[model samples]
Target: MDASIFSAPKIDCHCHIFDPESFPYAPGVFYAPSGGEIATADYFMQVMSAYGVSHALLVGPNSGYGTDNRCMLDAIRRGGHRFKGIAVVENDASASQLQDLQAQGVVGIAFNMALLGLAHYANADALWERIAALDMCVQVQVQDDQMAELAPRLLGCGAQIVVDHHGRPDISRGLASPGFDALLRMADSGRCAVKLSGYDKFSREALPFADAQPFTDVLLSAFGPANCLWGSDWPNIRATRRLDYGTLLGVFERSVPSEADRRTILVDTPMRLFGFGTGGN
Candidate 1:
């Protein structure tokens, strides 16, 4: 294996920490992360260290802890500034509650429509307003053509939209698909960003998804290098294929071949987007 990827400082824009032992799974949860899916904050830091990842944006998982951000809050507290977060909140979350999470290092809110359908957030206009008012972003994970419906409302509210998983495009439909096209149009908004991640989420093929390169190309062109972020959806929960931290770094390397572009995606962009200091945890 090549050891060069570890030589640079990198921030994982998206990852998770599930500690069912320290914090038991909440009741009425969608799914519990037993066995291989379980990953404590301590374990994730160790993994980051091993793979040359300096910091991470810890996204609060919807499963096993819906609207209860305590587990994620705990991880940010213990992470010692090495982690920032995107929290999941109830539709009617108050400003004070958002301030509480922001004070603790949460920079955004996660609206994972890919897991919870679009209709679940139909009445979220107020939520968007709150997130924008607090200077936080809406980190959205929508599949296929969903972006078309969500983009106008998101931009209309003046909330920064941080899209997840390369817009989770329908690969068979090609790049001009409604959702991805709408995503590209967002480039002009100066308020949208897409993660150069989650190849396994949409790709019909395997890891190191060559099938997704064309889409990646247009996204970079649309959003530009600065607006694009990279994330490792670590622990591979609810994922069909195996995912490794190191392997993902390599995939990123291949995806953006330019050294300057890679530097921006791996370090500069995230450091600017989230508030991560240099050096590993």
Candidate 2:
């Protein structure tokens, strides 16, 4: 692929940083990388530079670090303009702690329903107010089957909703799938936005992930360009097979196909949702 194709400034709205030695992983964490190929802030920066990604939203990786966001916080502070963060906090997190996180460039909180259940967000009302006061969004990771029950609750929380992993749809059922349909309905409500990410998680196919394009098309149509964001899901830790950063970028280009739409998904939408810049791409 031509490097020029990625010339427009891009923001990776979802990625992670893990430094277990400094910020040790929680005991009995659900998942942890077996090999030593951990992703760090400096490594992520190198990847971003190679891909023309000017900014990134470093989400707290639930699998490795659990709710300890110290590693992510340090990265955001060190990265300056190059990185922002989405932290994971306990339900009883105090106001001052949230303020401190906001001052450090954390624009949202992450709720990984796959690991933590709905009970984890039992204090949604309070969390909503705290995050809303900071003008932050909420990042949600839920399986396709959980959408119907979870979407309504998240929408009612009164904070901007960012659904992760193309809403983690069931590709076998396509658009007719109940969870995917609920995702579309949530997007239609105008309060929710979906991240065009984690193709490796949702697609049953191999590289190029052509099978996932229809889901992307429907999400773009339902949410429109402004409410949609694109992410590399870098390092692609969950991938069953080897994947390349450049190849994934090409997949996005081929899937979206229009320069205008590409600009929107790759640049404009994330900038607007994550508060990256003053103007559109």
Candidate 3:
């Protein structure tokens, strides 16, 4: 694999870490952490330095940690301006709470709807207004089947939105998938962006991640270089085998070969989205 890809000052836009024992997931919450030795801020920083990633956008995981972004926030604080966080708070968070989270380094808020089920955010529009007022991006995880119904509401929010895991599209249906088609159209309208990640969960086959290529290619063409970002979906839960981040980056190289495009997905796009190079620049 190419170690050069891990060159310095890289930005990783999506990652999660939590101590399951302390956080204690709530019942009825749709997703659970696939147990692994807990990964902490120090561990993340060590890994980031090893990968030469200087900045990261810490997305809160749906592991029942709910609204308690303490560990992640602490990590950002200690990372010393090298990090930003996307908090996971209840949709009904008070105005002051949102403002305080912003002060704590939260740049966005995420709704893990794809993993938790869309019905949970039936009031997404209302929630969007609060986050939008904060000038924070809204991240939603929607599977391909849910796109047609969800995209319209997402667009109506009139706020910047990020769709995770290749729009959670169903590759077996190919281009005919209405959900995927809708996402492509949304990307074209310049209203949204997507992450090329979590292929292990979406893919039908095993290693080398060949099953995920077609979907990744479609995203490249639809979102173009500027709107696409790549993520390792590190410490992936669905896998029976332990997959390393280096291998995931290697998978990206094979799937999207254009150096220019790779730079956009891995470097340029995230830099812009996360506002890299601020005085922190």
Best of the candidates, lDDT: 1
Please give, for residues 1-281, the per-residue lDDT of candidate 2 as tens digits. Answer: 33355676678888888777677788888888546448888888888888778888899887788778889989987885777889988877777898888888888998887557777676676887677767788888877677877777777777888899898888887797777888899876776888888888879988788899899899888998888888888767766877777887778788777778778877788777777873221
Model 3 per-residue lDDT tens digits across residues 1-281? 33356562356777877656555565665556645646667777788778777677888777646667886787788887878888888877876888998898888889877766778888667878887787788888888688888888888886788888888777688776998888888886685889888776677777676877888888888889799887776556556666787777778778888776777777788777767653354
Clashing pairs in 2: none
Task: Report the number of backbone clashes for model 3.
Answer: 2
Ranking by TM-score: 1, 2, 3
Compute each candidate's TM-score over C-alphas: 0.96, 0.92, 0.90
Off-target runs (Cα >4 Å) in candidate 1 are 1-3, 279-281
Task: Tell me the number of clashing residue pairs for each predicted model.
Answer: 0, 0, 2
| Model 2 poorest 10 in a row by lDDT | 1-10
RMSD of 3: 2.6
At residue 172, candidate 3 shows an lDDT of 84
Q: State the displacement of the C-alpha of residue 193, model 1, in Å, after optimal TM-score superposition.
A: 1.1
Candidate achieving the largest TM-score: 1
Which stretches of candidate 3 lie above 4 Å from their native place?
A: 1-3, 20-37, 238-240, 278-281
